[model samples]
Target chain A: MDTNPLDNASPGHGPVVALFVTCLADLLRPSVAFNSIKLLEQTGCRVVVPLQQTCCGQPAYNSGDYESIIPLAKQLIAALEPADYVVIPSGSCAGMICHHYPQLLDGDWRDRALQVAAKTFEITSFLSDILPIKRGHRAAIKLPSVTYHDSCAGLRELGIKEQPRQLLQELCDTELSELPQTEVCCGFGGTFCAKMPEISAKMVHDKVHSAQTTGATILAGGDLGCLLNIAGRARREGVDLEVRHITELLCGDLDGPAIGEGE
Target chain B: MEQHSDTFLENASKALGNKAQADIRDLLGLFTPLLRNAAVDNFEHFEALRHHVKRVRQHSLDNLDHYLATYEQQALKNGNRVHFANSGDDLNSIVLDICQQHNAQRIAKGKSMITEETGLNDFLQRANLDVMETDLGEYIIQQAGETPSHIVGPALHKSADEVRQLFLQKHDLGERELDNTEDIVGEARQILREHFLKAQVGIIGANALVAEDGYSMLVTNEGNGDLCANLPPVLIICTSVERILPRAEDATAMLRLLVRSATGQSQTCYTSFYSGPRREQDVDGPLETHIVLLDNRRTEILASDYREMLQCIRCGACLNHCPIYNSVGGHAYGSVYMGPMGSVLTPLLSSLEESNALPNACTSCGRCAEVCPAEIPLPDLLRDLRHQETVEKITAPRWRIGLKLHTWLARNPRLYHWLTGVGIHLLHLAGRKRGSFRKLPLAGGWTSQRDFPTPQGKTFMQQYRAQRKQS
Candidate 1:
């Protein structure tokens, strides 16, 4: 087999990135990871996935187990430390690393935490804010209509409301529909979904209803936790809709079934 | 008032099912935000004013003891008796002693959450003194023998029909048509006017206690608080120690945000400051003035990570914006201070075990923090309380163990991938036909309300590794 031409490309002129594949994406949908890599490569970046990487420790941190997250935080810091920039697809995980890590870790470890935090960027924001890919670059695939759900952590913690939408509008032929109270939580607050499921269900039910009212066939969001929640409830309610990560549409890879669908 | 905080879920469920309560919540959901938006738009520098008010509150809280001491000294110099109580029980007894010393028979009260917190009305009634709640909302709730639900509009949970029924049942006057809300209000006004004149003592909550001068500021739209203070021979101000401000201007800074936040108005109809009893030149005022400052676990909160909560001006903005409060009105919180503020304060003041569910009931939507005029991080405080619960082993054992196991797996990537890969594969096979699970073993709580989505067959890492080899 011939050597890949992209491999021989020099790294100095392009941004070097470490892909922090969030646990939800890693376990639930592998296409999101591949699409993320495709989008990053299209931007002319050399991306690396550290083998030692696992989760962002948000599940533990948000559950009030600060002590339990320490070892996980240390592992994450070590895994992502060698890259020029760390990019995450999920805003919740990125927020955990960028906004919460410094607060979670203590003393001498805090400086390293801050260093990791300062270099971390959510993928859409990395594309829009850091190395903005201009609009009018259409993807090969087209979606009929899609509504974007702004996950609470992504919206409130990281201020990532417009980055994904701007990218979607720029890269796809899909009509973007806005959901009512889209800034409100879809109730997939990590373990919060399990701890207070009734309240969570009510919130997600309302979210699904709002998305349905927008008459969009596809529901898109950057956070898989929220997508899975809205998708799961829509399936249960017999509401015919597709829920996919925005990266899949942006990268022109809609091969697999939507979230909570076929194996 | 009886506290059903321990049964918060049951109370919330009941409130959610009540049609009338839901209607009231919908009205408030529309009204409060519209008024707040209008108020904000009318004030060109409202955001800057919010920052100024936050700074003023922060400075006051930082030197709370100094301000409280200054307020006490100034109040005493103005010929008002200042009393301090360490607990709610102490506060109730102090008020009782004051009433007994003056042989107070008829007492008029203007919406005081401090008194509600201390159960002062019940205690006074038990002691044979006749107490009347003079605020229109307060009077309706009193006639119905129900507790105040909302802080600003105490009887907000009651609809117009309920108010009509309450007045028809309680009022001794002959059959009068209470057909409209205006007529109901007029009836309450006619009844309360008599109490306002005949009351021997009047008790009111202070919006802020000025330190530069011993002035207790009161904000009311109905003009009842003013009448309650001036008509009675004795006036008693019930407030917490944290309500003290350094100067009158600081109080103004607070009111700028408070009125806009509480009722969506630039200012209440009556904003009066009473420094002491009747002055020599005054036409009409109370003969004796008293200020009762209650600690009620505030000093402890000030010394803790929740010190920022003391800066809250009790504007009820958090309540107005909270989704949970909109879902299941304020009475479900089972605390005098309801919604986001109550969730944090109830657990701190009351037993954590008893009020344990309050913090967990929140969705952490951050709307409360978004609307808080004092810039209090309510979600962070609630998280802190949850952490305390975990540390104290107050949370359910199954959840703790589950979290511990998840933490153990997350810390080890190789093992985590191995196990989660197998788990996801098995789930995919089990759920391939429907793509979701109607019932899950450990996630019954989630599956009971909504189906659990099945994972994709292979883990992303496994697929990535395989794809890299193929390429």
Candidate 2:
């Protein structure tokens, strides 16, 4: 994959974007974060990774452990506060900052949360909404027919249905075959897969089936948690489809194996 | 009736494993959303109507006391007896007293989730009254001796063949072949027709209670509600107090959203508004009319953050669209109200301790809230219930301890990073060849169902820091 010429430009060329590498991306799949940085850099934005950022506090928030997540939320808000824009590679984490932060904090903290929320955008939406790289600037990525799974938080909470598709089609010039039940959950609800594994299995089973039915070799999505879940299940089910985060495919960073696949 | 929500996980697993009912649930999952979307797409002003009705529902619930009193007074003026029951048991006894006072033996009933919630039929049966469900779906489930697996389609869990067997086993219809859908309906119709004519008392649930005029609105596809309300000598309308609205137009506006969401129809076969009993000039109608309002936990719900839940109109849109509902079906919920609405309301009506798992039995997909005509935030309410669970320490100690450890680590990022770094590196080394783990210790729940993906060699932070130094 050829690195975009613009990506080599010095930092501070445009708006400063603090990349919020979500916990799953940081721990499980760093390629998502790397590709995300490349995409943002290609858009002429100065990308900064905030090391103090640990998580968006969703696991605690979703588990009803509000008391535990509040400080983490504050820590994240403080960590990403200085950036002109906070771009998350994952929609679930982005939604957490943009939507749940205001609900989680109060008073001055609430105002700060809203301020940070106003500038936070999921990676694909950030590229499409904040900095739309026209056709001339698009990277020449040759991908197989791609199908997408809309993560629940991103689809319903943030209305991220068309952003990734538009990016894939416009940027990579790839054929995007639509997955049936694209809006349905992939059964990786943070801790839900562990808490109610049976139901989660059924949901992921249905999701993998739908993806397989699409006949697309690659199933791409905005959130890594969902990708890991679908890819993990698809691997176990002996399905041949490759699961990837949309960022990885978009940036043509395919040297590493697909999710749940070894070299 | 019995709160089995505590056993939701086990119940869901059983439902998932059962091929027969799971097939039906899978079919419902596939088609119900399509039907709802088709109806919504066809209606040009579905969103506008939904918003308007949401306002109507919110306004009604906000001034619930005022509307309830106005309705009762107006109902009394129309010669209809209005009674309020503080609890489910209270409501059951009130209905029983009304039945006994009239010496009612055989009773015909329409589909009423409220009655199902109160276990009214079982209570009345204990009193030795021959009560029969008049609605085709309710009648089938009544004969099969099963609680409703769904609010709209009570016996939907049963296959057509299952229903055929149920009819043959329960009905004394000789050796008739109930092989087809039409034949099944005809058999049910023939049986229900006899009970509708013979029953001295009839009971039904109202879709909405118009407070401005003493009228109760009911929408039914089969017109069974009309038969149950008008054919008997005495009529009883069983409904919750939250069904009240300020005006007739409000009820009709809500009806527009309700019908479309519930069954994806523009209108039901019968839309009846009962304004008390028969007039002097009326030829045929119920001689006595009684309206029973049950307040199982409406007042408490109205006063809490979950007040929005009371705005629900029982459209079953949430149930139809829920993935969790699709996975396990309604019976797994172990309550009359199942699916997303039940997940929120069941805990509020009963103690959270009794139905804690019901709330957790969700992926928080927000599809329920997306399709809810009343616009109640089902996921948010479910989350609040979980919050309540944690605050009360109703959750398991091991789970809380795990959360606390994670929280403590999260607050201290250095420790979190160090620990996560070591853990990721270990996992990467262990699963380097396989790329994933078939069985992970302490993660059996996940590994049992799906493989756990291996971490890429180094943590992003570790790699990022190293790259930054090189750059």
Candidate 3:
């Protein structure tokens, strides 16, 4: 049973895509959004960046402020309603839209939320599942070997384990040294990082250590929050690792410094 | 024993600082899951069995009243007395009253988390009753006068060297260099063997109580439970009300999940079913048997939104897979129940106000739900507890206020972008040199541990708008 509605999506006709540029990607790393736009465009999609889009309300949702997330969910639904497909750069935010929106809203808003959720896809999943990039004999782009972090929400909530890996292996020429315990969270769990910093620190340190053990100079993941946490810790610990979003490498946006690196 | 769940962060900090224990926790976090995975993989029908057992548990919980009545009737017919304790105090008093009724001087106990929850050992000890733990792990923690850290392995936090020291100091049996693991076991066995024989009553916990037959099922690697049930003249099985199953097959079916999930084994060394007291043909068993079913707010949980938690088989798979539990270990949870299940169950068992920190301690990795044989949505349950905290204003006012401010800003996208754009651009300019900040005001929690990466120039929304205008 092909349960996924987006499984048969065709990109040759240039479907309209509304990019839900997550708050972290919007503020912490704008290039993730730009690169995501480029990737979507390359797949014959007319990508639209909705200006009305803000945060996905995961901070409020995760912190147990269900009252606050309702309005945010409605606003996001309204803002991104017109698109044929709503795309996101990060998995956690996409998870919020896909998994949690209906959980947080009610009645007609829930129906709208569900409609939007069905159309929403994380960038890698969007590429691989809906509008897969046509393969060619193009040479692999020059980059250091990388390891991938499976962001928790995407991997667990949406079953996004192989989509990104498959896409990265197909698109990026760099060797992907699979991270040990890649399924474990890097501990940038929204407000959890701020509230439980000591535990989060230990968790991120473990994740960074695991990535280091892979001996991959570059650590890449589909989500910006995890990359930022890993990159921040690696920099603080004086470990020479270039942390990047998969889109950055796939789109050849190497002009900017790696996460937590100087211009 | 004590509810320090409110101080979870502090305890976690202390646990992390204790490098030796934290390393053990890290190893446990790594290895326990691997072991469980191997067991699950070895079983061809693990997934099917997991679902089957989950349905059986849900059915049992759903028809709890009917099953409880049936179990009680069957148990009474089998010559066993059934007692329902409304609270921890009720259960402790009931057990004490039973011990006093027999004029029991020495009591041998098997590993019973229900007893732990009710603080039965401390209660009985306070009454000046000679109570001894029979399970090796329980005996170790009992000797140390400390609560069980891990439910399955109570003294898991203790090093073998510490156990040797404990045995040397506590065991009066003239020990000559108890160096090897076998010698230590033999010495403990030699001492516990006396207590087993002399004890007037044996107290153990049931893994499941079958309604169809009056038999209470228990599984253990140590066989101490069977010894505790049979050796003493009187036996008491202390377990939660949720442990009831419709039939013996249901009990065995659950065992298939529980054993694999707990120790990653096909079966424990011992799986015993106590029908009642000693029968006419039975050579050795307790003369009188009693089953104490502790309610302890479980009925309320069964009625509430968190009823799915009742399906938990106490496998500790959640604890093995939890990142938070991995980082801080079970003791840091500061509850009788620890790890993901503990976090969800502790608050429901106690007041959420006192244990709000337990729910908030989670990173919501959802691994617990993934590995749970009962299929409990542990992360969602934890999140709901946090929701209750918010609704009741149990969380700090500042945290609520911060959430409110962010929510309000998020609802208005333009203002959100404008405010965030200015802040991010300023941060980009400030930390553009270093590419991150070592220290920042109001971000002490984050900066204290790791650097905060600087934003990449203008916010994406701002850049997107600018690009749109240019085009």
Candidate 4:
């Protein structure tokens, strides 16, 4: 009946954020992990990426296998004890870890879910206002025209907006193209692409069409799944566009070949 | 079940779902955060309205025998006769019988997609009934002999030129060419006015049925539903079972979300709550009113795992925001409902065998969950359906074996490591400095179009183990 919907204020003693570098960031998109580090560091609070950290068991949890997720959630909560914050990168994983984990652990797990929910914040959010950053120190990075996409978890579960764009807007000469029907999902939904490849393909196709229509030379987003799907399609059509993590553009460490160059 | 065209899925897959998933990560960029911001901004609870509406529907369905009896009594009290339809045929017969009794020569309809679903017009026309559509969009699609692409915005998929061509070909115009949206709309308005005044029966779809007061809420942008219900001697409102709500206030709250999410409007141009037939003192309303609540397996849907599907108010907001519907358009869906809601609903509303392709039509990216007024978990539900589809063995046998093998290998770390190591090495050897594969075995559907980037050489487990030992 009563789960406080929003985290309107920071704790009196700034909450200690325990970083859960979701399996994707820990393994593939380590740069997301690193940039997340920079964002947490900007907060000027104790930020620790726990060594025992692993997957949020979302894949198994979403697949409707509760048994697998329970142990992992227990281990996660135990590994980061006395923690006031449990910040994570991926929206889907963070949402599952925060909302679903407690359900898996019925009795005491509800309290833990409350505990985790109280502290967990997506990277851009923590930096945007919580641990206030310098008013505006965006470095200039010359680049082709670009647009932004919001991930599902961050959009629906985490309520994240403006933080990434606030950061992106600060970077100089970044001509961000406005997406028509920008809030529509690209359909990379974790196991969804693999499960319903055909339907997933159509959604990505539509996303590419929107991007191409905007004449934005780049597609930028915080989440990897959306970018991966869109980039894959662009790679197929050989569209003259680059896809980069918002962090990579912010950090200005892009080393990959120009989109469609490899082809 | 009629099999899907399969091309839509194919084209979409080429765009979003493929082996390129692991390598790229920007697709989730815009939609995810836009919704997050919207929710944060839109958090004051309209829970009372939701509860009211839900109960209204339940109340009407429970005392359906009583409500039907009372609705009949009320309409009759207002000098209107009531007709009940147990099935589509029965409804068609009842309508036919009334039109025959009244000798209704011209029938003017105002955007009743429910009629299209029930094949009502077809039945009437087959019996030589003269039916005329009055709404600009409905009139255009009627002329073209095509079904509506969207519930609220019929003929949304059509460009002005296409509509112009249809009107020019069908409408009696000496030499004038129809140009612009206003011109087409004006042309239809001119054509339908005579039919509205002359038509004996006007059929409409109620946005909601209020149980508290025995009134029906019908809101329209052009005031077509009003004209259809008011000017005619007989008015027929055909609505699904779930449209009933407890109170008019709840309808107003639902209207707030409905109009805003659908078209960003505070309210429709014409919002009216009609109770029973017209009074003698009333300026104008139908002499006789009919409210037909069609079951059509809706009762079955309510009892199933898909009860939430009934929560849809048919605002077409999901379609308005759906990526799949935005391209190739709605005719491609081959069903009345299209987009996220359509993908879930078509199967439930119709034969699953034929409409099975609808559920599989989602990318499950979860954007549909963001803009939903009723807050339906569309992406998650779609994923659940996919799991059910696999369980039902509706998927091909080869897929079953493949998924089983993948799940098996994933469960076993030893085999998973060995297999992935070999797979990554082969991928590296194949692509090497090339950085991508134009083609790969088993999943050539992806590689044929795009390159699959070779792995970073060391697996995450290997990197993690080495780093751990060093620490």
The C-alpha lDDT values of all candidates are 0.85, 0.88, 0.88, 0.65
lDDT per residue, candidate 3, B1-471, as tens digits?
443888898888988899988877787888888888999999999899889998999999999999999999999999999999999999999999999999998999999999999999989999999999999989998888888888887888888888999999998867479898898899889888999999999999989999998789999998889889999999999999999999889988889888888888989999999999888998889999999999999999999999999998898888888898889888888888999999999999989988889998888888889999999999999999999999999989989998899899988877888999899999999999899999988788788888999888998888877875686
In CAPRI terms, model 3 is classed as medium
- Over B245-358, each residue of candidate 4 has an lDDT whose tens digit, in order, gives 656776776787677666556557999887767786988788887777677777787777777777777767677566555533456566667778877877776665565566
After aligning candidate 4 to the native by TM-score, how far in Å is the CA of B61 from where it should be?
Answer: 7.6
lDDT of 2 by residue, A95-120 (tens): 88998899988999999999999999
Selected candidate, larger DockQ, 2 vs 3: 2
* Per-candidate clashes, comma-separated: 0, 0, 0, 26
Off by over 4 Å in 3: A1-13, A135-137, B1-3
Per-residue alpha-carbon lDDT of model 3 for A158-192, expressed as tens digits? 89999977887787777888888877888888789
Candidate 1 Cα lDDT to native: 0.85
Q: Sorted on DockQ, highest at the top, how do the candidates line up?
A: 2, 3, 1, 4
Pairwise DockQ winner, candidates 3 and 4: 3
Error of 4 at B114 (Å): 2.3
Candidate 3 vs candidate 4, lDDT winner: 3
